[model samples]
Each structure stands twice: as C-alpha cells, then as structure tokens.
Target: MHEVDMTKCLLISLNEWRDRREDTSAMVETVHLDVGRFTCVEPDQLVTTYNAAVQGTWLDGSRLTITEIPFVGRCLICNGTYDPVPENAYRSPCCDNPLEEIVSGRELRIRSIDYRSDAAAALESAPIQRQR
Candidate 1:
C-alpha cells in the first residue's frame, strides 16, 4: 500500500513537469522541489522515490534538487526571528525569547524554471519544486 501511494505521488509530480516540458525550443534540466520541514516527508525517502519516479520518462536525465524549508519563526519572548536548527539545536527561549509566528520558509512552489526558447520553437519549462 505504501509503495503504491509513493509511486502515485512520484508519477503525479513527474507528470506535472512533463506536461510543462518542451522540445525543439528548450530542454528540461533542473527541478527544484520545495520540501517543507513540516510537510512530514523524509528527505532520504523522498530522494529515493524521486529518483525512481523520473526513470523511463521525459524527466529522465534531469536533476531534482530538494531544498529544505526550515521551520523559522519569530521569538515571542524576544521578537528575534531565526531559522530553526535541528531538534537538538532548538531552543524555546531563543535569545531569551520564545517563538511565535513564522515569517517565511513554509510554502512549497515551483518558483521559476530555467529554460530557453527560440523563434523556431516556443518551448517553455516550469519549475518542479521549491520552497520560498
């Protein structure tokens, strides 16, 4: 059951990029995936799945870079904003202040794609993954 679900997820992600892939005008290369820290996805697991998913498809030979989104927030006690380190590095009283709401680094998006198009072809590529 887990395997099926994971494959499905991988297929969907690839399909999205493939749908946006173009030839004769531009070539697909990098796919930056925005992986949220709170998204509950294991980095190593995702990497393994993503690598397998891109196989035998148009996304083949392309690179998938997963950018980790840190759990950053403002310190409620001190109002100091900081990027969340590892659990061991997490401090409740940050700079003597507690944390409150986050300012950024929670969203996952395609951001932008790096591709080129010419007069002869009208190819364009969309970003695969990103977190900003």
Candidate 2:
C-alpha cells in the first residue's frame, strides 16, 4: 500500500510538472521532495517505488531527492517550540505541558523540479577544449 501511494505521488508530480511546462521537449532531471518525519514513509522504499513508477517514462532517469523535516510541536502553556521525541510523543520541555499545536512534521509534497535544459545538454555533449 505504501509503495502504491508513493507511486501515485510521483505520477502526480510528473503530471503537474508537464502541465505547467506545456512543453513536451523538456525532460525532468531531478525531483526534490520534502517529507515530514511523521509521514512514516521510508526514504529507500519511496525511492524504489518512484524509480519503478517512472520506468519507461520521460522521468525515467530523473533523480529523486528527499528532505526529511523533523517533527516539531509548540507548547501551549509556554509557547515554546521543540522537536517531539519517541516518534509522535509530544511533551513540552517547558512546564511539562502537552503540545497541542503542530508547527510542522506533517508535510509530504514536491518542493521543486529540475529540468534538463537544451543548453546544458548541449554543453555535456560538446567537445572539451583544454588549454595547454
């Protein structure tokens, strides 16, 4: 089920990128995704699923970069922000209060997309002119 979800997310991101670009000539080079620690999705498994999903597609050779966001919560009593330990256990360091507000750590979305520009590709294929 997790693999399916990851695949779906990748497909959705690719589709969105295509829609925005509207240029079929553009090829994706890298996909940057921000995932929260609380999302419970393993990075390795997600990457594997993404590779499988993009197989034979325009994004086949694209790299997937995941940035993990730590679980952060705000203390209601003292208005202090901190990272929750023990995975989902939110206990305020100040006043020993329960954290009721989540500042972050629930995100799962694409941050940005990198495309293989024509000039960049051309430069790669260009011959090297080394100076003596």
**What TM-scores do the predictions have?**
0.55, 0.80
Q: Give all candidates' CA lDDT scores.
A: 0.60, 0.82
Task: Write candidate 2's Cα lDDT for 1-132 as tens digits.
Answer: 575787696798688768776456778888899988878888878888888888898788998899998889899888889987764456787676777898999888889988866766778899999999
Clashing pairs in 2: none
- For model 1 the local lDDT of residue 128 reads 52
Candidate 2 deviant stretches above 4 angstroms:
1-3, 117-132
* 2-96: candidate 1 lDDT, tens digit per residue: 43464466568556755675644354577667767755666567666667877786656666567878777777777677775556344554474
Query: Judged by lDDT, which candidate is best?
Result: 2
- Each prediction's RMSD to truth: 10.3, 4.6
Predicted structure 2: lDDT? 0.82
